[model samples]
Target: MNTLFIFLLLSTISSTLGQESPDPVRDIDGNLLQSGTEYYILPVVRGMGGGLTLGPRSDDLCPLDVVQENLEVDNGLPLTFTPVDPKKGIIQESTDLNIIFQAQSICVQSNVWGLVEYEGHRIVSASGTPGNPGSETINNWFNIRKFDDHYKLVYCPTVCSICRPVCGDIGVKIDENGTRRLAISDVPFKIMFKKV
Candidate 1:
């Protein structure tokens, strides 16, 4: 009887740990977003300009900051969403993940989106190395959360248990030059993933 009780307890724990989130992140066509697949993170709001692109916020910088394209132009580089555990195959909502741009940046070698402090605000830019999920590269991790009927990008990573990362929703902040830059804000930038 004791053996059966222990076995049942372990089974319950394993099942709970293995269970996936209630909703898996899907593309515009209602298809599950697979790991390593290329997609464009587009804003759901009508006049939010275009998808995410890479450019310097001010004078030429090494790691080009992420910015939104012009309103009439929706051409932005494709991005790959990689979950912390690649074995999961599908990206589930609220799971810690890494977003890497497929295109190469002339300024910096890394194309992974990471948070960097510029002008007293945390802004998303391409300056991260993939795979290291500790406190060292805690800024590299991101999350896609469900917002209303759409979704939003979040910077709340759970990869490091001992690290207390500043958690916030990712939104757009216009720079002095009138460029929309992705930054941590109280109001999230509602978005949807489009598979390329």
Candidate 2:
């Protein structure tokens, strides 16, 4: 299905069948989110090889690169969104989100924060996944929703909602010469999200 059509469908569905209403979609300035929760994420367009997952990452590669590189080698497993801090609604690729079965965070320590302006991209960062340590504000906040019966991380930004990862595109291969590794296409990422 077309991405726009799907988004329109989700807009309609989210208004009625959607999970939370008037639920504070973004954290532009206010911090309206609980602390310590997991929300899975997906890319706008499924890349040539795999999907986007949220989880821990080193300070070197951007968070998304962690998945992009790993999935290319290992089986393409999904990822989840863990918050850096519910108040700030920030997320960076750190061990704080390394909860078991946790979604591999893509916001690297160089660093990246997934959701805030949107909705439940994530909700508060724990001590971090088990690697590096540090945090930041929600300049790149976004949200995901149950759109058309699937999950998606929608990033229709007002300003600076997302960062630049030139190598994020499919088949782009690794970031040569220290190019940015994160990428968000015009299409929002879609994935299967369950509350388990």
Whose lDDT is greatest here?
Answer: 1
The C-alpha TM-scores of every prediction are: 0.90, 0.34
lDDT for each residue of candidate 1 in 1-196, tens digit (9 for 90 to 100) = 9999999999999999998755799999999999999999888988778998898867767668889987735858899988888778899899899899899767855888899999999999887879777888899999999999999999999999999998999999988899999999989999988998
Clashing pairs in 1: none
lDDT of 2 by residue, 33-104 (tens): 223443323233444334333333334443333333234222333333443234434432111222222443
Against the true structure, candidate 2 has what lDDT? 0.34
| Per-prediction backbone clash count | 0, 31
Cα error, residue 91 of model 2, in Å, equals 15
Q: All predictions: root-mean-square deviation over Cα? A: 2.3, 14.7
Off by over 4 Å in 2: 1-48, 51-138, 156-182, 194-196
C-alpha lDDT of all candidate models, in order: 0.88, 0.34
Q: What is the lDDT of residue 82 in candidate 1?
A: 87
TM-score of the candidate numbered 2?
0.34
